[model samples]
Target: MTESKADQPDEKARPRRRQARGERRIQQLLDAAASVFCRAGYTSASTNAIAREAGVSPGTLYQFFPNKEAIAVELGERLNRRMLETHGVVFTLENAALPLRELIDAVLDPMIEFNCANPAFLTLLQSSDAPGHFLEEHAALHDSIQDRIGELIGVRNPDLSPERRTHTANMAFALFKAGLGLILGHEGAEREAYVAELKTALYGYLAPVLGTEGVPAQP
Candidate 1:
């Protein structure tokens, strides 16, 4: 028998609904995997543990991801993409034109926030046991910071040669990463202190090369 027009719409909608639910399930599993990886480390985490963390059965988890490695790789990719998005948002021309202190705040705050919220990302990044391809992907992501920062710096300090700009960007990221580790290691007042100290360090470090704190960049 031919279906009615109204019934056809419902039938077509059914597939979309199923696809949406499937996407949600995939997200759920990935979130669970991230949490497990964060708490247990990549080497110690198992598929069953991730299923438990996700509040799903092992079979349900397996329906989406065949093994723990697949889950870790997918989670790493998602986290990397999110970090790149945050990077893009924070490194705008407006941000680059801010005064030195504000520039440091604008650039570093989101980075620290991203790392804090997604502790699992740090775990995956530091993990030697993660999938090889994922590690290569992450390494490429680290390289993006230099390119982005070099561009931002060049906009402010066009007089500097390309080599100097690259070196400065690398040095800036290194300092920020060092401070980030310290900031993440503390709490409350201590964390705030570390953040203040980081800004101070960056201000001093970049002042000569970039300019004074109160003065905004020309471009």
Candidate 2:
């Protein structure tokens, strides 16, 4: 029997809804895996526990991801993407033009917020020794900071050389990562103190490249 044309739209909508459901399932698995990995570490985290946390069967978990490492890799990718999106929203041209200290604070604020809100996320990052092919697979994403900085600098000062742009991006991310380590690995006043030091180090490094005028005047 021939299907009615009217049903075609409904059929298409069904597929979209199913895809959305699948994506949600994958996200749930990742969220649960993040917690399990954080508590147990990568070497000891079990698929059974992750599956239980996700409220899915082991078979269902395997259907979405082959194993724990795949889950870890996907979670890391999502975390990186999420961080970039959060930072991107906060780091506007106006904020970017702020003194290097303020700019660093802007970037670090969301990151620290994310870590505090999702301690499991940081634990997962700290658990692994850095995925070996992580850089290769996520090179574009990892370099997103540099790319955005390069774009902003180009708009502000067209003559900024590629080397200079690259340097600024590299310096900023290095300090950001170091700050993240201190914040995630420390607690209370010590964390606050480290963040202050990190801001100073980051701004001092970028001041030469961005110039005092480009730097945000206030923190």
Candidate 3:
């Protein structure tokens, strides 16, 4: 007997619909969490506040997350994944031949944009009241970024010994982190000036080791 299209089991479609709804709900919760954390700080943030921000009942939020920490963990994981993706693009062979200034810009621009758009990331990470495990997870992501930056350095400056490359990479990451702080801490002309200065400083530090000479003067 031939079954009508509408009479088919439709098992796959049912799960797909349910999964899509579930994902949408989770996104709502995370978005609300980000806003709440940003405004209230991690310690002051509460599940009830997040639920209100999400426009869902407290029970609904609990269905997706056990507590505020779980919400933070998920958000941190998502941000780390994005950072990895940005680094992957910047550290590729295609970008290895870029001039020192352009290379640093390529790496820093996307990262800075991400940080600016997701201010809660910095807020949650820097808060002393955040869970120890959450901080540890963030630290691990930072280390992964540093390791990849070391690899990129080796690719661009093949003569550098592994130890020297690691040291340089660590220093460069520290500088980049500080640059992020400065950018976030200012606005308008000051932020633009700080960004320019950061690029020049990075170029000067990198040029000697990367064997790139006579790089253009800073703007």
Candidate 4:
């Protein structure tokens, strides 16, 4: 009778409850880590500081992540995954077919919004002391994004050779990164102004590169 009782639904539920709590704890730590990384940069951020930010003890944080690098690696992976999601929305066929100005608006706004909100993404990406594996992963993420941009360009301007398409995508991404640095350097109205500036710049560049292919009319 005792052995049978051990296999009851209540017993199974206990592990699940514990797992839910563990998951929540992990997320809390990650959120705190983001704040710390953004404020102090990856090289300067400490596990103790992250623990304090999360309202937990240092030991508690250790229970989830072995070290600061582990926390950074996990955070970088999640941020990179979130970035990949942009392809589904902004890089779609419909958006690709929009006018150059509209395409710039549709793509850059949300991308900028994400980077502004999650400044730690840039922190991890630019950190000189970031873990080696994380940097490799970020490199992969960059290539994937470039590939997506190339595909989007091909959709609008199919006449361009593959080399030209790749070259255009690289230039567009480089321009966005440069503009992003300026955009992220400021806050509030200044940042918004930079966003507008970036869109205008992109329009000027893409207008001629994309030509008159499938691009729709702009107002």
Models sorted by lDDT, best on top:
4, 1, 3, 2
lDDT of 4: 0.88
Q: Considering TM-score, where higher is better, how would the candidates rank from best to worst? A: 1, 4, 3, 2
Lowest-scoring 10 consecutive residues by lDDT in candidate 1?
210-219
TM-score of each: 0.91, 0.69, 0.86, 0.90
| Residue 145 lDDT (model 3) | 87
Clash count, candidate 2? 5
lDDT of each: 0.88, 0.74, 0.85, 0.88
The superposed Cα distance between candidate 3 and the true structure at residue 24, in angstroms, equals 0.6
Tens digits of per-residue lDDT, candidate 3, 84-140, equal 777777776556667777777788888888888888889888998777777887888
- TM match of model 1 to true structure: 0.91
Pairing residues by index, what is the TM-score of model 3? Answer: 0.86
**Could you tell me how far off, in angstroms, the CA of residue 36 lies in candidate 3 after the best superposition?**
1.3
Clashes in predicted model 3: 0
Best by TM-score: 1
The lDDT, on a scale of 0 to 1, for candidate 2 is 0.74
| Global Cα lDDT for candidate 1 | 0.88
RMSD of candidates 1 onward, in order: 2.2, 5.3, 4.4, 3.6
What alpha-carbon RMSD in Å does predicted model 3 have with respect to the real structure? 4.4
Clashing pairs in 4: none
Off by over 4 Å in 2: 1-25, 55-60, 115-135, 150-161, 213-219
